[model samples]
Target chain A: MSRQTPLNAAHRKLGARMVDFAGWDMPVQYTSVIAEHEAVRTAAGLFDVSHMGEIEFHGPGALAAVNGLLTNDLSRCADGQALYAGLLNDEGGFVDDVVAYRFSAERILVCVNASNREKDFAWMTARARGCTPVDRSDEFAQLALQGPKAAAILQRLTPVQLSGVGTYRFTEGAVAGVDCIIARTGYTGEDGFELYCAPVRAEALWNALLAAGAANGLKPAGLGARDSLRTEMKYALYGNDIDDAHTPLEAGLGWIVKLDKQDFVGKAALERQKAAGVPRRLVGFELTGAGIARHGYPVLKDGQRVGEVTSGTLGPSVKKAIGIGYVPAAHSAEGSTFDVEIRGRPVAARVVKTPFWKRG
Target chain B: MGNYPGSLKYTKDHEWARAEGSRYVIGITDHAQAELGEVVFVDLPEVGKQVTAGKPFGAAESTKAASDLFAPVTGKVVKANEALKADPSALNSDPYGAGWLVELEPTDGDTSHLMDADSYVKLLG
Candidate 1:
């Protein structure tokens, strides 16, 4: 049986179409993917992201233990700051991409993908030097309120000053009479906040947010819009875009990998790979001809198969068919031509600058 | 459960064929469109192309994935929907009407294997 989130019934009440996503019975769309995608781009959209896993480290050694596992330099972050980082295996490939929130030297929380919850906890616990990793996935239900109007809608319900919480910064406060960890972060490439609250208070918080934001065109979005929104921003989805086999350098995520930092799990292997140079790199492309490119579709150069697409979709905001794939460094340049084998036909495609949709 | 027009014949693959004189109007069912989410592109077979029963003739691309469109009866394409190229979301908004995929001139006119609305609804359950 698939696991259900705290707001599963609420989604059903909103007439959402449910699907099994990474073993969780989740809402894929409440109306249409395009509508939800546009809603987030123009107004605001709410999402039940409760399935995301949370791991906690508490002790005087928490900061060092958590920082040692991540590729990003977490020690640079001050209290109440959150940073995106990669948890790589010993071979320099990703275990999972994660967001670490530094509440203090004694308390840190890492938010991980739902599918990697059990595996990530075990990996961290085994390698942790001084502190035991605690799996807190089921303790909190997460909700994301995202878009241009997100601040206005969220400010109405929370006592915490929304403007004071800058991007990637968080503060613990009460929202709509419920205690929550209000983090100014999101995956949709929008100005928003992720509210993490107790599971028992999820329904009330969800209803309150919906009621407060209803006038501002806040719609209850689902996983469908979330996927497309992130795709437009060139954000990598675990398993689809980044995985255990592809290192951060090849995935166009070198910015997050601080190789100069103290010894991490994959430091040695990454050092060697960096010296050898990255052979293949991930690139963004748009179809020049008919047909939408999809994941697992063959990418061809001069009619010969060279690579495969990792994640693709017809971008709603951009109004074009766009995709990301891994290609040899020689072919991973801007304006390089390629063919995405759609069905049995080769449709023309061209490499382009990333983040298909840019905020104006 | 979704809207399954009673007058049309349905296939287990979720396609609907409406008999129109010697040609059959083809379109995906409402249930199929909803399950596929928003249809971003519909790849229909060109006019004069031959399509065989139980075979893929085109595809419907959604924001999430691509689903192949299978032919319900062996036929030759007489006319393919041109409107879908400009606004594919018509497939999600009006799957049975404006979203009609193609008009096929059947070689044998055989649709004995296809199910009616009742049977198709039962299959969905």
Candidate 2:
């Protein structure tokens, strides 16, 4: 059996449809995916994201030690700042994508995907030359409050000024007497806060926040809504849209890779891949036929397979069958035509921008 | 609406099969569609295509996931839902009515392998 989060009882109480996602028994949806998806896009939605992994790196050389482990330069990171970065193997394959939060010059917390917890923590510990890496994934719980009114909703409950935290920044404060790490980062494209608190105090804080935001139309969200929300914004989900086989350059995540930094894992390999030019690039498209494009669907050009969709689903907000996939870099141009094989028939599609849906 | 209809037989895979003279109309159970979320696409099997009981003939895509549209009883496809070709949300609106995936001429007259609404509801719980 997979592990259960602290919100498991609460999810079951809300009539959630439970599913095993990456070894966590989590709720996929409560009522409907479309309604929950629209709620987060237009209004507010609460997500139980305690299943994510959190590792604390500390010591005198913590900054340099952790910086060498990540592709992004940590020197640019200041207290209350967060950086989106990736960890890579020496061969340049992706280890995992993470969010690094710098609390002080000697302290940083890296939030990684839950499924990669053990592997990521091991990689960091094996390379800890002058610092300590602690696996604190189980010591905390997190909730994501997302939408346009997130800040307004959260401000009433917390004494701290909510507007002070900029994008990719965090504030360490108290909420309902609990030490909370409020970060302005989220998988969904909307402005939001990821609230982290003690594992023992998680349920109480969740109840407090939900109670505060109830009348404001902040409904509880689940993985189903989360998937649709991220898909609409074209955010990559590990294992589906990204994996160890793809490089940062091919995955269109080159922005997170810092080549100017000193020798880091995969630095030389990434440089070679960057210089050689990537053959396949991740691209987004909208299916033009009677069917929705989905993962594993073959993309064909004149009956020859060019690539397969990595992630595909209907965009509830945009009302379109949008999908993202890896295609030949030559066919990655906007408006380029291709066909996705759907149940034997070649469904027409066109390469568009990354996000098929945008919030107004 | 609570479960697969009583008179209709069901497959463990979730499709409901109802006998109509020499043919059977096949679609997913209300439970199936609800679990799959809002249907966005339905891949219909071509008319005259042969299918076996408990085998996949086509697929359905929804906001939640991709579900296989299984043939409840062995038959030859006679009619496929053409309206769903462009808009699959029709299934969510009326899964028992317009969302009927296909009509097939069954090779056998007996539909013993499927379940009625009462049994299907119990299976869901």
Candidate 2 lDDT, tens digit per residue, B1-125? 46455678887888888789889998888878887877777878889999988889998887867788889988899999998887778787777888899999988655776787777777787
**Per-residue C-alpha lDDT of model 1 across residues A158-214, encoded as one tens digit per residue:** 889999999999999999999999999999998999999999999999999999999
* lDDT tens per residue, model 2, A239-355: 888778888888888898999997788889899988888889889899887677778889999899999898888788878888899999999999998999877789899998867
RMSD of each: 1.3, 1.8
Say which candidate scores most in TM-score. Answer: 1
Q: lDDT at A192 for candidate 2?
A: 95
Model 1, DockQ value? 0.84
Best by the DockQ measure: 1
Model 2 regions lying over 4 Å from their true place: B108-110, B117-125
For model 1, the TM-score of its B chain against the native B chain is 0.97
DockQ of each: 0.84, 0.77
Candidate 2 docking classification: medium
Model 2 error, position A82 (Å): 0.4
